[model samples]
Target: MNDVMWKRSLALFAVALLLVLGGCGQLTNSSSTASTGTTSNRKVQTTGNYSTTGYNSVVTEGHYKTSAARGVAADYANNALDVKGMETGLMQLSQDVFSPNKYTFQEGQYISAANVKNWLGRKSKSNATGLNPEANGSTDPDKRVPEYLGTMVEQDYMTGSGSKLSLGGISIALGMNAVDYYQKEQYGATFQTKVNKDKQLQEGKTMAQEIVDRLRAKNNVGNVPIFVTIYSLAEQDSLVSGSFIAKATATGKTIDKWDSVDQQSGVLPTVNNQKPINSADATAFNNFKTQVQNFFPNLSGVTASVHYLDGALTQMTVNIQTQFYGQTEIMSFTNYVASVANKLLPGNAPIQIIVSSVNTTQALITRNSGEKEFTTNVLQNY
Candidate 1:
């Protein structure tokens, strides 16, 4: 071939090689493997951002060995949320926050048996029992499994507390807090009706201690710590107001006044117990993102905030904000807080849960629909 012809062929060959290389490496506008970028693995998380963890609720049916067991469950469900029982803490939080009622009783009206079944899940034929004392009145469960119904996902705050005694016999676990005779009289307040809040407080602690003692005697939960926390609105509100509950009761009697401790917000220790469960939980949550950063490094930021009440470490919580890509997801401030909170409590270990995304909520639905949405709240008054 002539020198000129060879030169022309070499130039064309060089141009073809450049085109092939460019096509393989390009990410945009190319129909090749390199162009198909991954969005899942490339999520850039940011703090204070939310991605909407869907609007999912859960209903759990729990069983108790005896009446006293109910009290132990009661405290764990409410005020003493600091206790590290996965079932008691998260489930109670769900019910308390999003309560579901069986039926709406009008002024001067009584609830029907049919309506009661739909509300508390008591087989319409059999007397409504074991669902919720506050829901189905006079229908006490006799060692039967109570049915459970609710949103898809739920949390389990496991405990070594009084598992044997409380989780011993079949004490149907229905998380329905319908307003009934006892519920109407008192509710979650310390001095509901005439019940002395201080005395009731002692009863709960005593019940928990007794229940734990029985569990230990029976060799049920082993060395697992069972911290029972009974709820009385007055006591919790007082703690939030910088006051410590010296003592409270539920027997329709007055309680000793508690002075506010405005300055200290669980900063200093109070309980002389072995480990600082509350403080440890707080610290764990604060540094949670750092712990998970290596696993999912595409993080942009975190979401949520924690609030410190007064004196007691029991009232302390840490709020986390997890941001990814452009989507903002808010799972549960209480969930993360309690998750870390459990780490600090006197339990065998922290709670375990399977978290997921829930994007849809009532607020995001059709605004013009002329329909009333069902509103419910679950309460624990053991």
Candidate 2:
């Protein structure tokens, strides 16, 4: 047989296998329903829930979370920082920074401001100066202390020799009211804008120094290395772009030296060196879509896109459009599409399959050996 005819036969064989595996419920359901004579634009929505049955524990829903954080980091590093990106970046960074070392903290081993004081054998006196000790007469007992987002003792594999060094790190979310005010003021015709920006940065530096000092007082941290990260929030409580604002390190002996937000170094490492999808990959993806359409004639259209990181495919998304009668048909079609794509796709990267109709949409995500299945309603016109 010619190549075209051979591909057709293979497509038909795959569809027959799908129909058999889909069972009587799907066939009966599909046969009973007729198309409503109305044509409406389909809106696509996606929701996901993960299952970690047999895959490596490291690759989980966290991968998507990290991906999002990386996107935010890229925005900041490239000077495209915006309110939404800033907020998202900080929130995701908070989750990403502590996740890898979660298991290290035992039941009561987590770090806290109060506990750190006790660990240093210091008295439990509240800071009368509140978050900013430099502001005179601002000693309101109700003033908020540095909100500790998270803290953990991480092992420094890169810096330690022979035995790994226990590195203690603290994450804090700080208010950006001063910075926001300065940003708005800096736009004015007055020369104070530059002054205000400088003052705000100085205040940020001071706050960071105070935090480090409190954590290191009287050798509280002993010989372990302590790292502190301050994430600043704008007036609306959203994260400020390029607002990794302050980072300080102390060795429990000398004073902590704080640095202004280093635009180049503050970005999370995972986001660096990402590779864009190439022409060759695009061709391969197009071929895969053609094969899928041949295997599933009911599909009205099929679209595919690939996501890459450091010259390797990290994710592939396939959207299948069709007219479906009910949930049974949707499930059957989704399963069939996922199975076919899983076989055709290369590498162990995650695959996202989105199946949509006029009024409903479903998403099936597979990563490594695990799978996440969820569905959503299409409420708006596309």
Candidate 3:
């Protein structure tokens, strides 16, 4: 099936599943608390930057057990607090982000009731109570497998007081598939919905408030600023703010307030003055897109967005959608786009390229400094 047809079919199937499994109870998981330790033995240290030691300890102590959860937690702990005009000297308070990596069936896939039961049985061996809490003596056909993910916390250290004030942020991950299911059931909504419902915002606020209460009680810190981030894991795993659902900030004893996740933007470090995308840059990018279309006639779409900091281009994200014949085709197309983007963009800034087909998603982070990170995941086979 074509991409458009595949998406429609998935939506229909989700609606059917919801109808068949209506009135199911929400999934929940037990929280396991791990103590936030001192940084005396930490190998890395920076005076004003976010605490690398604290982040590493969170991972090392098994606060975040899954790779996906840890990846999300680390991204927030490292980059969320250092926005362009934000204050410095904030330390990640705790690394425990959240619980429950809920199971989600990807698009273009279906499971028989027997198979789901078998899968749950296998998952139970790893966790004492099984991954799906609803599976205990329940015959719900649409049960969810919720496993503990991880957590991340950031705080500000008070100078000359030897006390760390809470001034950073915390992020929790809600499995994307679970979120998709809930959104459909709650509002019959699609992913294209620009604004989240008030109910969703309230849920985020409650989560943030709970985190603040726990942190304050644990560290005896006074009222300080905190940003609570909620990440929804999609096919492409990245901490780009756009991929998140809600980002809320709170201070003192006040309740956490939610902001528009759709209006979020990101800035790269090292650039001093932020600048808009100039006509020349846009023309160059358009020319490159034309070249890509000519070379890869099967490509469905190509687009790019530039990120600036202090009047200098610091990063650009290029997204491409096409049907790939195989892994080789996907890699070749991605590398070619990376090369084109590198030449089109100025300076030593990084470029993130995302290529998506019907059942596969691949991403590449490339820079003029010769640094690269690539990841590819095939959700299904044609």
Candidate 4:
């Protein structure tokens, strides 16, 4: 692929990656039938891959479009960010002398470079000027059982030493339709506009379970290390959607944000001074305990209190404390993860942590309110 075509190919990859866990409300009821009509091919799956026939998917049913991977066309491969990719990306992102080789694309029915380049989507929006990936049923697809993940996500935290693919750089901006592929196929824009919600949710659940399993294998494999993970996505009562991968840390410091009506005062920070918190962070803290057992001659179980300051700014504050322990290199660990995260995926994306015998107290201001400010205080270890 030449620079232009190769650029577009990369752009298409970006389009395929901005996937959210949008789909049917819940599969709890019998009346909620699948919006996707997978009967056409009889042997196709929806993962926004090459098989998708729907708007953003390949599977089609009724008037609503589903997954492009499940759709009729077949040029795209499965999510490169799949478990396979995540593992590889993490490994790659861990290098001191970062010498990343050109990553090869997963095998899909090969489409010509020209086709990918000039490919404008099926239809077009009038009076608009841009390029988009066309729906030219050009490539054939791979038919195989996907390599799945295990049941624990926290265990899959990309820690230790390895390099990984950073998903949100130019890769995300273009492939996800931010730069426009051909015409109406600015695919990223079409997700919410075209893809089915039920399918996305189902995919999310499957992916979630797989992520959990892998995480457990990675972190817990060697004597149950304290594994930390940040669980993101929308959750309320029994209904939850969307999913995310976050840094695993031993610092269980989180600020809960509630209310959507106002940003100025609806969100606030909370400090957890109690033991046993979110599972991911708790595990991370435990692992830290093992690592630091030899230090802080006088260490006792302490807690980081997280409380929200119900006010105009939506923030979370954590009060770090310890019952028994010594000086911790908190900044060093945080920096290391931040560095790895930057190398793998570049952006302002937040990283979560689970802490042990140290009190890491601070207010995380989430809202982009004007120019940001910072303040720090030195406290006694005792």
lDDT of 2 by residue, 250-294 (tens): 556443576545321111101235332354555555566777677
lDDT of 4 by residue, 313-339 (tens): 111111122343334454443343333
- lDDT by residue (15-98, candidate 1, tens digit) is 332343234311112121111112234321111100111111111122111122333333423222222222222232323222
> Which order, best to worst by lDDT?
3, 2, 1, 4
| Superposed model 3: Cα runs more than 4 Å off | 1-196, 220-224, 230-246, 256-258, 264-286, 293-350, 354-382
Query: Which structure among the candidates has the greatest TM-score?
Result: 3
Model 1 per-residue lDDT at 237: 21
Could you tell me every candidate's TM-score relative to the true structure? 0.22, 0.35, 0.37, 0.18
lDDT of each: 0.26, 0.37, 0.37, 0.24
Clashes of 1: 67
- Rank by TM-score, highest first: 3, 2, 1, 4
| Model 4 CA deviation exceeding 4 Å by range | 1-200, 216-382
Pick the winner on lDDT between candidates 1 and 3: 3
Instruction: Kindly give the stretch of ten consecutive residues in candidate 4 with the minimal lDDT sum.
Output: 166-175
Specify the poorest-scoring 10-residue window by lDDT in model 2.
50-59
